[model samples]
Target: MSLWGKTDSFTYIMNQTKNLGLAVNVISDYDRTNANEYIKRKNVLVIIPSLVENSPYTVYECLINNVNFLASNVGGIPELIPQEHHAEVLFIPTPVDLYGKIHYRLKNININQGLLNHKTILKKLGLSQLNEKTTGAFKKIDEANSPLVSVCITHFERHHLLQQALASIKSQTYQNIEVILVDDGSTTEDSHRYLNLIENDFNSRGWKIVRSSNNYLGAARNLAARHASGEYLMFMDDDNVAKPFEVETFVTAALNSGADVLTTPSDLIFGEEFPSPFRKMTHCWLPLGPDLNIASFSNCFGDANALIRKEVFEKVGGFTEDYGLGHEDWEFFAKISLQGYKLQIVPEPLFWYRVANSGMLLSGNKSKNNYRSFRPFMDENVKYNYAMGLIPSYLEKIQELESEVKSLAEHQWWSFCQ
Candidate 1:
């Protein structure tokens, strides 16, 4: 391996190697146009030792060639490798830590499968070929009267990410907005310190921060909702970042459509590189009909992307805390749909969903995703909804059939084992 350029760190690294008696090569004035082919031919892995970056395209070029890469996990560098591929990619925190890691990779590194996945991501992002959806314009609401919007954010920890999220909100084009931040019983000193700083700076402009005693997602969001003072309410996750035009675009859609729930599709962004903002997207959810039809409950549109009217919150009684962590958003959407509230989807990617390497979805945390652990709570909720006439009887029957199918599959496996 060689250092591609001349730098103080490179010089220091070279000097450090004097005791070990190893050869050092500094490739000067290397042409980037031929870098990929050069790297592929040499079967050499690219090492990016930058302390700060924002989703560099050089990493993708390496991916295109199936060449292994080592990057410091700063800025959006951690997002270069998808959450599923974190185990394979080297995400180091310090440059000195790369010494042992680089040697380990020389002996045991297979990146062909990662290359295939990278190709899939490129296709998914439509980066190879531009399309109409990526190029379309965001529709505007023609009214001049902008209503106040309460943006509710519920956070537990990860203060660094939350700071970015708050900055994104502060930079919104729609100025007639209020932010309600709820710190859900953060036990970390770092979180408390960050929240205290935010409280001093952003406590005005109808912004309020509440610190609760430890109540998880649903309750924390409910606390924020209760304190909100806007006609329209937007739920945001602490880890997610909103576009500058996000609030304006969604408000325009909501005002034009007069729908109870206005939502737009979210695009996945690794690190900090967001796609061209406020563009029409091909993957938006369209209603089956003009009204709240029965088919609306089949899929959960996710609460993070939703902008609901404050009245709708009062009618549906916010989210059901009894349902707990996993399916609370799904159940809330289902409940509101059953109550005959209209849902209108804004056909643009207004939100940037940060897919981190470790989270509830990808961390393989049994405490979060275990079906058996959640089955009883889900079953009781279904029965209660059916009893209260909030859900159709057919849904209850469908649940029973689904349970039967699961049991039959388990029994078949047991029989095979016998």
Candidate 2:
């Protein structure tokens, strides 16, 4: 048996397998060429004894290559396997359980049957259908008939990053787009110089730049929205680099679903790595759609970088312009949900979100007193439900406070106070 994985746990895994009297050829490093060659071998059974997993790509790879695999019945693994073959494909992740399954698969090696089942599984999951649907949608919407999307990008002295953001916009596959670059009172000489250089180019491209005096992100976005002429508005931060198909995919989804607001998944990039591949630095953030019970306390409504209908945005009164609170997106999304606006997720990572050590989010964390300022947007029922969700934590805190009070009462100074 050949073992292929990262070097971090190779030594430990080798030791454990050797102790079990299993003869294993360990290949610590993972390479596509080596993996492809290994999978092509006859009578090869891929073993995945993962204790925990979430939508492992190994299953997909095996299915696509028509290779059979025995995986642990954990997480989303079972969901990916065909129901009829679950008894043969899934194991308990224990040595004895894995050994039995391995022996069974080896004895009954039927590549033709496996290949047919794999194709059926892939089709059922809609993995094979996504590309066709996307291509069809793209062909249906031409430049003349496509709705104009006004991309509102807010900038605050990140001139160097702004260049990449603007470049991304220019490289978009969607041609019916207008750029609204809002400069929120940039004080740096470099910022002014860069803006001045791009002014003529921006004007020629029919883009507008709105200048404001340190109004923060919320106000800046709102100001841009006011100047926008498109039917749909897209919000983007100066630090974010959008994928080429970002706008196109969003527009198609909006038209198809008739959703009032749409948000896509994002891959996180640390610092100023503008255009990194998916998950090069960190995991992809798959933001969930708006749910009032969750959105009231958490920002489960995705990022501010979303495509929204202009009328819906206007109805929600735009983003809350609280100076440094840093949750205007959450508040705005929650408001939309409260008012019965249809919000949907595109289910694809179409942008790169830059994560820095210091930003509005960090500053906002320091000012927790203003965290609940968005409560005004929530109605009485929502507030009550949110409070109920906090009851467990509140009760724990109350117990601690009561213990402290009892300890103080037992002190010698307590009698003098009474």
Candidate 3:
């Protein structure tokens, strides 16, 4: 038996399996090459006994390679498996259940059916094989006709992170782009020095560095928007890294949909880890359809890292200058939504959102007063509807009946005493 993985848990598993007098060949360095080679071996069965998972890619890889696999029937794992193959592929996480399922699968394994199941899932996910000859050719838009996108990035003292963010923007597939970096009052010498170096280095690229005095996040974004000279404005935090095709995708989506405001999903990367094409987790936020009712209670809308038409942004009066409050993005989206502007989600993860241990969101969450301050900014009609929506019609009726019963009981008691 072979065990392949790179995390600390994988090491623990390797040691535990050996301690139990089991001969397990453990490959500590886990990568696609090693995994692919192992899967190609004759008469092999992959077992994923995860207690909790979210659409694991291991199952997909096994299916793609026509290899038999037994996975726990846990979060999103069952959804990936075809309905017909459920009894064969999925098993309970317990050792007894796993062993039984493993024995059953080894005895009745059908490689052809597994391949067919893989193809079915691929088709379902819109990833089926494409014919290059019949596929439409790429049409290049005229240079003059292509819209210029201004990527407005707000920065504080994290110059290192800002450099990464700028590098990502510089690597965009769409060439007709200008970057506006807002330096929101950095007190550190290292940050200041790095900003100056970048200002000189990127001056030839038509990128401008706007300086501000401790104006906070919202105001910093507004400052960047003010200096922008493009038809479309894209906002990004300093910690975010845009994908190579992000600008191109947003431009194409904008033109095709004619949406005034556009937002895309992002991959949530923890700590300082760089974004990888193969790394995907279910922990990230997925933008839902536009619903003002849901938006009132939570940010159903996309993140602040969004693409917007310059005219629409100007019309909405830009982001609110609410310093230290993290819900500025939510409030700005709600404001534009209230004004009947079209806010559309692109449904593709176009960038990487770095989630650090301590950031503005953590600080904002610590203060209970933040949401209270934000409530006044919402529309009165929306607030009333949101409050009313919380109580069900049956619950309201029950409350009314209870009130009447209490009043009647008090009157009877007074009458009996008299």
Candidate 1's residue-wise lDDT over 285-359, tens digit each? Answer: 333332223333334354455788999988878875643345456556666655568876777667777766666
RMSD of each: 23.3, 14.5, 18.6
Per-residue CA lDDT of model 3 for 224-279, tens digit only, reads: 99999999999999999899999888888887677899998888887876676566
lDDT of each: 0.69, 0.81, 0.79
Superposed by TM-score, candidate 1 places the C-alpha of residue 190 at a distance from the truth, in angstroms, of: 0.6
- Name the Cα RMSD for model 1: 23.3
Model 3 misplaced regions, further than 4 Å: 1-144, 277-282, 365-377, 380-384, 388-418
TM-score of every prediction relative to native: 0.51, 0.62, 0.58
Model 2 stretches astray by more than 4 angstroms: 1-139, 276-281, 365-377, 380-384, 388-418
Worst 10 residues of 1 by lDDT: 368-377
Q: Rank the candidates by TM-score, best first.
A: 2, 3, 1
lDDT of 3 at 14: 67
Worst 10 residues of 2 by lDDT: 365-374
